[model samples]
Target: MSVHTACPVTTRKTLGQVLVCLGCCCGRTDKGHPPVPVDWLKSEWKRRMLPKKIHLSISGCLGPCDASNVVLILYGQEAIFLGGLHEETHYLALADWATDCDHQGCLVPLPESLEPFRLERFVDEPVAAGAA
Candidate 1:
């Protein structure tokens, strides 16, 4: 999937922000979802000093609970939702993507490797009554 330029949430000029969900279904191995490498991710973020350019928040319940290992990335005017990230390489790619954006001082297209994980979690149209 290609990068989506518009996000229904808000259009704020942020360098970038990453939110990794650790709630209910996301990082819960008991829920049949793969484990999130919390410690490694934190260490990598700190090692790269990404906080200066990219905001990282390991949060609870970013919703869409079925989408385990969810990660929401807001960059510039776009919001990228990625799910099913169950590998170490996925986390590495996240760090690399953040580092690249930090070096560029702006938002950049997500690496091709991560395209498959892109999720269309938001919809422009409201759900019709009684739709499931």
Candidate 2:
């Protein structure tokens, strides 16, 4: 039998926001919430909220108790984290917001409907605190 290796999938541009979407998020919260998805992230990312050269990656567990789907946004200078969002629309919104972002790399203001599940910034790991 011949083994077939799938070709590598590559993008054209180096996405402005390189996110780490953690998969297989185990554990539930006090309010009975499940972990975040491979698409979930720290809801308050400044750069990710805007539309720019954004690249969202879905990876493995990001480490923590409360967060399920952890998103790690990365630019050239800094990085950001997000969590607890498991809906498809939210993912789309995040993607749309990550385009044409400002140099400051701040969280793009989102609609009221998508504000509750924002992530708690990891003080130990400062996010996107570098040159915007």
Best by lDDT: 1
lDDT of 1 by residue, 1-132 (tens): 556655478543458899999998888998799999999989999999987678889999987777789999986567889999999899899999999988988878899999999889978898999999
- What lDDT would each prediction earn against the true structure? 0.88, 0.53
Candidate 1 lDDT at 2 equals: 50
Clash-forming residue pairs, model 1? none
What TM-score, over all chains together, does every model reach? Answer: 0.82, 0.47
Candidate 1: which stretches are off by over 4 Å? 1-14, 127-132
Score residue 16 of candidate 1 by CA lDDT: 80
Worst 10 residues of 1 by lDDT: 5-14
| Per-prediction CA RMSD (Å) | 6.3, 11.6
- Report clashes for each candidate as comma-separated counts: 0, 25
Worst 10 residues of 2 by lDDT: 35-44
* TM-score of candidate 2 versus the correct structure, residues matched by position: 0.47
lDDT of 1 at 78: 76
